[model samples]
Target chain A: MSSSSSSSSSTELSIPLHVKYIQSLGENKDDLIYHMTSHLRLNAIYWGLTALCVMNRQDALDREEMIAFVMSCWDEEAGGFGAHSGHDAHIHATLSAIQILILQDASDKIDVPRVVNCEPSKHIFHSRRTLPEMLTEGLPLLVILSLQQPSGVFAGDAFGEIDTRFSYIAVQSLSLLGQLDKLNVDKTVSYVLKCRNFDGGFGAVVGAESHAAMVFVCVALLAILDKLDEIDQETLAWWLAERQLPNGGLNGRPQKLEDVCYSFWVLSAMSILGKLTWIDADKLIQFILSAQDPENGGIADRPGDQPDVFHTLFGVAGLSLLGYPGLETIDPAYCLPESVTKRLGLRKNWKALPKRT
Target chain B: MPRVTSNNSDDEAQLYCEKSEWQDITPIPQYDGINPIAPIFYTPEYKDATEYFRAIVKADEVSERVLQLTYDIISMNPAHYSAWQYRYRTLVALKHPLDVELELMDAFAIKFLKTYQVWHHRRLLLTALRSSAPSPLSIASKELAFIIRALSTDTKNYHTWSYRQWLLAFFDDEELWEGELPYVERLLETDVRNNSAWHHRYFVVWGRVRAEGEIDVGDVLKREIAYTKDQIALAPNNPSAWNYLRGILEHTKTPFNSLRTFVELYSTQTAPGEEDIVDLDNPKPGPGAQLPCAPALEFLADIHEEMGGEQTKKAIEIWKSLGNEYDTMRKKYWEFRVKEALSV
Candidate 1:
């Protein structure tokens, strides 16, 4: 491979090496860093697994064992999953668990009610069709729905701290579980529109500054909810395209240092808006490739920084969306394999760049 | 490496499982022996601490000992939401002094500034403090001070900024909202390109719709536009200030051409030739400032486009310059803008 040399300018992604890095992550049981990051274990697993899948190397990690670990993190009392075993249930960890299970074809492990599959009228609040009784009972549907605040935002957990991120998670989780029928779509969407700033970007919450990551959550949520018409797509797309820096990497916001992760966050939003061609794809591809640890085999936040699963996943996911060669397509809205979303009938109108030869 | 004698004297050396008083509590391991998948091999310290935590939670215990355990666990892992939530419950149940707890959390919050749970825990504490304290006003002031200190470390930490916004609105006190603009000004003075400061300025200025008799909305919009122009004068390249300028215009339903001359000053290609022009109404860029600045040029294009007919052609010309010369990085976007405008 061209990566044998120490130069950071290698133009090709070290897919084999990244696969090795991920495989090695599970072997370091004695590493204290592993234990310290237990709170993010499930998320880490999802990242690692999704990265491997995008690289067309899904078998890099053991599927059965991964599924078992996800199930083990389930908080039986809360009807949601925690980050790890013995950890309390959280909305985020629950989403990770659901994603992992669905990817592994083990979603039946999640005890969602059968009534969730019935689709209701679009954006119409039926007087009789309220929160489903089965969902209100101990189930993942209730666990997610209960977190929605009266103002249409969502708290991360029972702790009552709210963010637009939780709203996206809730939307995605409900959609994935086939329970969109129960969601108060107008109420949920009203709050997101409130977070829109003049720059045509969304924020983490109302009155917060627009950020690329928050843009992804809000835009993706709107896409999933089929509420994209509410956003000013052209203005937002222009703002997103402006995130690309001279170095080719994109920043989360204006005047911030470019990081590899925004390649996904910014690109995903643009992709959903059907404006993926607004930014320089070739330069961004080069930038994402440059952030790879050509030797040790993981992508970092930037060149010369330490590599981790989160950035590695985002790096690959970004490349996949940019039509990088020899990778599977990723759904810009779902952040899952495009195939997975299609199979689940949850794919939205988001577009990825055409796959390269 | 062996445990040092000096470290042994501190609470760090003690094991929760080894303590005599905790003998009644059985440590519940994370996984059963039947099929352990990807179990984390925790250090003796963390393993013992969490196992005890699991046991205490299972036993429904909320005491001082549980508080100490949760704190130790949290110190080791700040993202431990369960530990933070459990600790908060324990504090509330025990009727512990939350003010003292907030004082202790200051150091921890700084240490774990990036952790979501740390900020959320602070929010929970303040919410609790709001009801228990005799004067929520003092708590609000103290929190604002603490947030100012925190912002000194990271001027744009999303959590800290949002918390400050939430604090002000939650208190709904005039004094809290009154100091916010100056605070935002100080932050902007430190860094003109700080988007968070610009955003906060907008939040404070236009956050709540004023009653008709309270303040003149037109005057406020005028002042905001002027302030934004002044900041834009400091750094014409800053998108944040430019966006704020446009934002103020959009919110007031003001036409873009209203700032045509000011936008023209920054969007012009030719240099000012060291003429030292000082105009407060429409300040010119500094000597070293890059002329035909991209954001300014974009704004200028928008202004022209807003005029329609013959002026739309002028907008297309500026956008063409942006795509073909000034800002080729987003050449496609500018081209799209041109295409959209031509189609219209």
Candidate 2:
């Protein structure tokens, strides 16, 4: 193993290193960190796979194996994917699972009909449903719709914890499943509009401070629902553009530290708003590249930090949005490969940076 | 099902068993070029924690042992959401007192004030108690006090603010609604620039119109306008106050030009014919220590943009100065505004 290097001169993304880094994550089953992060295992796989896809190395990870693992995370009772096999179903993991399947072109493997209608009564006597069948219930869309609170914001689950993030996840998940007609679009859009602060950015919930991540979710949700005009675009774009610091890294909120993840959050919003030029792309690309673990295969929150799959995916995804050379273009609205989103006819009007030759 | 061993010393056995079972899976290629594992992943303590968590999950046991295991995990890493989930499940299964769970969460809340799971767990407990509690309003009031304490420690804590908003939704009490503005006033008195406090203020004032169904919005707007003006006078550069001021004005449909007193107090001017020039360097500010702060200029520009002809020309001038002088970081944005104003 090589030593961690802190050189900023290496502006190139170490795609091969990152590919290996992601590959190495699943190699050590005995590692305590692996078990510790089991809850995020499915999300991690999506991050890793998406990062690989952005790097033009989508096949680096074994597809069959990856699909098997994602299917394993089915929470049978809730009709949604859980973070891990034993974890309860949540909207987040379910979205990640669906995205992963779409990326792998294995979406057809999902038994939507069985999963959607699989009732507890049906399962009680049969005991014959496969693990995937038990978990991949068509109920996810219904479950997601059910989580919509009276205020129009969605709960992450039956726990009734409402957040704009959940709204975005629900919107995207339903749209992907062609179930947008089932959603209360007017109510969802109204709640999102209420979360808008005077700064033109959105918060996780109403009355919360505006954050770049929350802005992305709200904006993306609006775009999906075709209600982008409901917000003050110019003011929001100004707030988003201001997220960039001198170092070219973006922060979630005012007075927060710059992080690599905001590259996706901030840039995606800018992309959707047709304000991609507002950002200093070259400097941001350099910042994202600098956060790469030159020795490891993943990117970190910042330089000198340990690399993780979450930041790695976002960094690469941001780079893709920035029109980095040889990388796949990402749909800023969905955080998926442009090709995949387009193929599914779920693409919106957002623009990515023109890919450099 | 695996026989769950409670011995902490058997961590290695737990790891070995899990590893052996997965041995048949094809190992991923390790790029020889990659770096060694970070030191953070190699600690014995981390290994033990993970092993204990694995054993608990494998056992699928919702016992006191699992509760302790989850608590141990959570103490070290409050952001570990799965551990919190397990703990919540265990608490519910064991029928642990909601108050006890709340008390246990207090230490975690203080230690990891920003952690989402801790705040979420607190919300779950409070929500669970809402239906059965003899006095739900009192419980909500108490939670509000707890949240206020949390906010006092880190005035801008997002999770705390969100939780506070969540808790407030349960109460329809006029007294509770009445208390909110003063509570915000107290917070803003401590820190005039606390944006969260300002946001809470907005929620209280505007939210009342929706919640109560009969509020004298005109009166509230007048009071809020005065409050924001006072806040701005205290700190002209405070964006929170400016935002609050703008929100109140917009909600009330009070035209920017209609704020005659405010405009006279804060308006800045550029030299004749110089307004058209896009000065990239050494832009001039309006004369004086008090007038033409960025927000004031921007607000005036908005009003002028809404009005046409002569006012549009004046708005362009203000935009030019704002781009170059007061809000230089957003010079390009201000320039865009100028262009937009000129086009109008």
Candidate 3:
């Protein structure tokens, strides 16, 4: 990573302050924003935990308390997890629950089936239906697989709102649970291919405009499925590289404002494609650092914006992929700490820049 | 979804927990006090509403009262998917007029444009309306009009654009696709740099490549290439137009050199003079256009590289200039491109 930029003078990650900020997030019980954000509660926890992990302060947030929160969000009736307690189960929240469990070395908390025992149902299924033999074990795996439509795209919930994002979540969750063999890889990959735009970037759904966040999900899911050969790598890389603006921040789509979150969305996809070297690391590091709230910690979408956990996690994850100093390496394909993915033996072919000293 | 604060005194004064009709239901707290983990301190108002919501779900009550309760929950937190799902089920069970429900959603959709549940609820209503309504086409048209109004507020909202795309494809009517191109054109005209509008253009034109009674593919290609050039002239640095230009060429398997002259028009840093003669075949950048546009330079380089032999040197120079000067943010990408080409 290049260090020859004027950004080196006034910008530092302020990891200590950021760690404090994350630790304090759950302490305020009376904040109205807290109640309003119950729908994103589980996902927010994952982001905070992952950001803390990336900064190499995994223990800053009590592991026992964090794991308990994740388990509390489990929706036993739906065979999956929800965003918060008393909320219905959703695929997005289920993935976050699994991610947090793995990050905290609590993967064993989720009991898995010894073998795939989903018997084909006699009744006609809209898609290929697999009746779960044992619901107690591998319930999330069942919930996820049940959501895939005949078109191969997974729905966020029973409401049937399909997107490439859910496809990625399903793939990632199944892979983490060691149940990827149950997924129809070909069908899932074909759906992702359908979402690809002329610019070589992926979108939320077929016929929608390409966005960097969707690109990351599609690319990472493809990598997990070992179907990297399917994409137009060079074309997509060029599109991803072009997302970097003159200010050194990346945007999710063309002509959009530069946001810190796209730093991870664009960079993670590029890293999975082995095109991480294409970005100007020095300038991007400067941009990500500039978004940091030096006094209170946490990174924002842009400089001077109120910092939030979503952008904060993305910012730290982007910095980790950029080889920022004294940070844990994040797995580009999974968004988990490299150590976690490596230990799980689920790491895919991805390349992050060399860690800067 | 961020909290949508209401200034109405009525909204502030109302509390379901205090009402006599809601007295029979016991509120269910999100977490029991036994070692609650990262518990959200919900407001007394939200707490009351959600507690009653839990009671209704447990009781399996799909009634008019449940509708009002779900609405109160949703108004406070638009992303409560459970509330949305329950509300839809209630609407269906009560045999309520979905059009009236849709009318209620119109303002809510605009108020919470980015919320996924809001759009999804609209999708469910439209899907239901289509199957039962006498004229599905009328429903489709009105929904399209509503989407246009939603797009006016936030032109690039992902949910709005994708929902619009879903609506067209769902209807699969010739009339729906017919008006799509002109609608996209107006959006592009308003903001030439709108990628969503440009993507919709691709969806409309190329999506009809071999449809029955459509225009010739060859004619469509020529018209699109010219249309893209005109857009590029308006804003030289706009990557969306350039990407569309490349998309058209690559999708049709047309050679990059086909537009070499047009590509060269914006390759140089010089702006056109007021008296400069206009060329219909090659559009010149407007006075406001930022010259030495990186995409145009890259296109020129690709054209030269396609020619092979001595022309490859010209491609190398352009690539070097892009890295060293024009687009320094992606300097490393240009360097890598040159290295990859040389190695091959």
- Interface RMSD for each predicted structure: 5.9, 9.4, 5.4
Better of 2 and 3 by DockQ: 3
Candidate 1, which segments miss by more than 4 Å at Cα?
A1-9, A108-138, B1-10, B20-24, B32-35, B274-277
Query: Candidate 2: which pairs clash?
Result: A17-A297, A18-A297, A115-A136, A115-A137, A115-A138, A116-A137, A116-A138
Q: In CAPRI terms, where does candidate 3 land?
A: medium
Q: Which structure is stronger by lDDT: 1 or 3?
A: 3
DockQ values, each candidate: 0.46, 0.16, 0.50
Tens digit per residue, CA lDDT, model 2, A92-152: 9999998998898876664322221123454422343443353344577768898899989
- In order, the first chain's TM-score in every candidate is 0.90, 0.91, 0.90
TM-score of chain B of each: 0.94, 0.78, 0.91
lDDT score, residue B310, model 1?
Answer: 98
Residue pairs of candidate 1 with colliding backbone atoms: none
- Evaluated with lDDT, which candidate comes out highest? 3
Show the lowest summed lDDT stretch of 10 residues, model 3 chain B: B1-10
User: Over the stretch A1-357, how does candidate 1's per-residue lDDT look in tens digits?
Assistant: 335544544688888999999999988888878877888899999999999989999998897778767766766567678887656789999899878877887655443212211123321222322123323443778878899999999999887779999999999989987889899999999999999987799889887889999999999999999999998998899789889999999999899999999999999999999999988999999888888888889999998898998999999999999999899999988899999999989888888899887
lDDT (C-alpha, whole model) for all candidates = 0.84, 0.76, 0.85
